[model samples]
Target: MSPLDQLFSNYLPVFLGTGIGAILVISALVGSRLLAPYSEERNKGTTYECGMLPIRRASTNVGMRFYLYAILFIVFDVEAVFIFPWALSYLAVGPQAYWEMVVFVGILAVGLAYAWKKGALRWQ
Candidate 1:
């Protein structure tokens, strides 16, 4: 077979799949637009807050400390997740896996130390 024919044969399935996916998405969107209900009530566009009328605008300032605490929590949470599986299987894997996990925990410890020194752990 010619190179052009071979290339077309290899890509034919991909092209067909993409075309079919696009058609399906477009048809779904068009069908939703045609069949969905339309509303013009005054309260329809108002802000909703737990079934109660919103008392104020939603936008507000959030302290950077909140984000820092969230990041630290996520980091340690992931560390725990990794450590659990390794703790269960480390005996079978031997000393190399143990040392690798030690290094991983060491890196995380250094990060925690740096964050502590920078006062990221401080609440006030």
Candidate 2:
């Protein structure tokens, strides 16, 4: 068989399975919409927050600082997560892996230092 045929033979089952799954999901969504009861109640369209009646408009101005803090937390948190798997296999990976991780950490440290210098870490 040719290379394309070999490739298809190897992954044909996976492609078929994925196609079947997509078809089933689409059918289920369409079936639910067609078979389920439709409601036209006005209250159903209203904004509900924590089971309490909304007092004012939902779109309110929020401080950019909150988003900055969240993004910084995510970046550092993801970096911390990479350390765990590296630590587990460090012995096998040896000195190369160690130096790579050190470089990665140093880059993150520079980013943190820059943020600190710019007062992004300040709560204000």
TM values, all candidates: 0.52, 0.53
Per-residue lDDT tens digits of candidate 2, residues 3-101? 999998999989899999999999999999999999899789878688888988977998899998998899999999999999999889799999999
Q: lDDT at 13 for candidate 1?
A: 93
For residues 22-59, write the lDDT of model 1, one tens digit per residue: 99999999999999988799988978777898877777
Using lDDT as the measure, which candidate wins? 1
Residue pairs clashing in model 1 are: none
Worst 10 residues of 1 by lDDT: 55-64
User: What are the lDDT figures for the candidates, one per model?
Assistant: 0.95, 0.93
| Residue-level lDDT for 16 in candidate 1 | 99
TM-score of model number 1: 0.52
